[model samples]
Target chain A: DVKVTQSSRYLVKRTGEKVFLECVQDMDHENMFWYRQDPGLGLRLIYFSYDVKMKEKGDIPEGYSVSREKKERFSLILESASTNQTSMYLCASSFHSLNQPQHFGDGTRLSIL
Target chain B: AQSVTQPDIHITVSEGASLELRCNYSYGATPYLFWYVQSPGQGLQLLLKYFSGDTLVQGIKGFEAEFKRSQSSFNLRKPSVHWSDAAEYFCAVDQAGTALIFGKGTTLSVSS
Candidate 1:
């Protein structure tokens, strides 16, 4: 079975602090994505990486950035954490095809104070 | 741009009852539709997808969805509801590439 693992299941951060959320997939998929999920708003894509060192901004990528240094790992970076950024973060991986389904990680619940 | 809509924000049903969750999408041409389920504090799981050929598609966990081109709706259905089936459901549409645009989501509650 394919497994996507996030570095932390839950995290707490103070305002203005930098945060890093790590995601690793064992499937060797070529595409990785980062999304923040909020109540009523659902999951909005923050960023996606199709290959190592390649990234693209999604709909709600204003306050977030991502890094893909290796084929199996993708990281989401919060330059400065804020209260509004507090939400559940999900990481997903999929094949390079357009119709392939993405497999997701367990998710990280981030709380900023 | 592609968009998705899930009109119902929440729905309640009893166990062993049939269930249906409505999902509609907006796109210019043939669209790729998908349905996903997310449990509390967990990532979303793909329930079913509709690409081409057959309009009706069966998915994991006894879930199925039918694609309607005229209405642009792909609604999920299940014959019997289980207590463990309670979760938030999302409808999504993929336009030009791999990016998926999702709806707000509908929370399903299963009553005893």
Candidate 2:
């Protein structure tokens, strides 16, 4: 079983505060992703890293950034948190192969006040 | 223009009854389809995926999905429903190893 762990299950922060959400995978998968899950919108990719120091922007990359410094960890950062940015953040990891499925962490529910 | 659509927003089914969730996609070429479920307060879990060769693909937790090329549909079905199966189901489409385009999602409600 693949284990993907998020740093926090729930978070709260004031507007304009910088926020960081972390994820770590145990399977040593080469691909890591960060997404925001919103009602009626499903999951929209924010950023994804194929390898260490390599990152790509997804459809909704505005106002968000990601870092992958090591093989097992991926982090999503919010430069200036806002009320609209409050969402459920999810992290997923997959093997390098395209046909493989992504394993997900439990998710972190972020609230910006 | 690649997109996935799940027409149903919410579904209510009795325990032990058969279940089916509809998923439709629009793409220029061959598409990889997948079904995922998310429990309350949790992330999405892959239920099944359809790549090629086999139109009917089985997945974890006794879920199966069938891909129909003519309709560009990959529908998920289960022989029996359990209470624990109550969750949000999403249908997604992607190219080989690309970012997935997901549907709005369908929420399943189970009755005792």
Candidate 3:
């Protein structure tokens, strides 16, 4: 089974703080993704990395960035954590196949105060 | 842009009852479609996927979805629903396996 691990299951941060959310995949898949889920909004992609040091912006990429220093690890960075940025964050990894399903980690529920 | 639409926001059904969740997608070519379920406080779980050939695909937890090219729909269905089946369901479209566009989820509530 493919395991995607999120560093934190629940997080609390102060407004304007720099927040880092880490994700690691055991399968060594080439693609990793960061998504923030909100009520009534489903899940919106924040960023995705197809390979090490390569990143692409998703629909809701404002105020957020990502790092992929290693193939198995992808990091989501909140440049300036705001109250609106607080949400459930999910990380996923998938093989390069066109129809392959993404494996997800247990999400991190972040709260900004 | 590739997009997915889940028409029903929420649905309630009794245990042992047949259940169906509607999902529609808009794409130019043959779209890679998926259905995912999320329990409260948990991440999304892939229920099933539709690529090509077979129109019906069986998924985990006794769930299945059918792909209808004429309707541009991939609707999830189960012969009998259990209380444990209560969760939020999302339909998504993949852009050649690179990016995904998900729909606002449908919340399922199973009664006793």
Candidate 4:
């Protein structure tokens, strides 16, 4: 079975602090995605990377950025964290094929004070 | 624009009852549809996906979904509701094979 691992299941940070959320997938999938899951808004894509060192902005990418230094690792960075940035973060990976489904990590619950 | 919509925000059902969750999408061509379930405090799990062929797709944990092209809808159904089935369900559509456009999600609550 494919496994997607998030470094932290729960994280707490103060406003203006820079935060980094890490995710790693056992499968060598070519596509990686970062999303924030809010109560009513559902899951809003933050960023996605199709290849190492290549990233694309999703629907909501204002205060966030991503880095894919290695094939198995993808990182989400919060330049300046704020209270509004606190949310559940999810990481997913999938094969590059058009019909492939994405595998997701357990998710990281971030709290910004 | 391509989009996915899950009409119900929340639904409650008694154990052993039948279940159905509605999903609708607006796209030009035949769309790639998917159903995902997220347990409390967990990430989203792929329940099922419809790429082509069979309109009715069976998913994990005794769940299934059917794609209706004429209605532009893909609704999830289950023969019996289980307590474990209580979770948030999301309907998504693939946008040109790059990213998925997800619906707002419907929270299912099961009562014993």
TM-score of each: 0.97, 0.97, 0.98, 0.98
DockQ for each numbered candidate = 0.73, 0.75, 0.87, 0.85
Q: Which of the two, 2 or 3, has more lDDT? A: 3
- TM-score of candidate 2 against the unseen true structure: 0.97
Over the stretch B1-112, how does candidate 2's per-residue lDDT look in tens digits? 8889999999999999999999999988888888999999988889988888989999999999999999988999999999999999999887568567889999999999
lDDT (10s digit) by residue, model 1, range A1-113: 89999999999999999999999999989999999898899889999998999999998898888989999999999999999999999999989886788888989999999
Ten-residue region with minimum lDDT total, candidate 3 chain A = A95-104
The docking category that best describes candidate 4 is high
Residue range B1-112, candidate 4, lDDT tens digits = 9999999999999999999999999988779999999999999999999999999999989999999998999999999999999999999998877789999999999999
lDDT of each: 0.92, 0.92, 0.94, 0.95
Supply every candidate's count of residue pairs whose N, Cα or C atoms clash at under 3 angstroms.
Answer: 0, 0, 0, 0
Candidate 1 stretches greater than 4 Å from native = none
- Chain A vs. true chain A, TM-score per model, equals 0.98, 0.98, 0.98, 0.99
Model 4: CA > 4 A from native:
none
lDDT of 2 at B19: 99
Q: Can you write out model 3's per-residue Cα lDDT over B1-112, one digit (the tens) per residue?
A: 7888999999999999999999989999889999999999888899999899899999999999999999999999999999999999999999888978899999999999
- TM-score, prediction 4: 0.98
Best by DockQ: 3
Q: Worst 10-residue stretch by lDDT in candidate 4 chain B?
A: B92-101
Clash pairs (backbone) in predicted model 4: none
Q: Which residue pairs clash in candidate 1? A: none
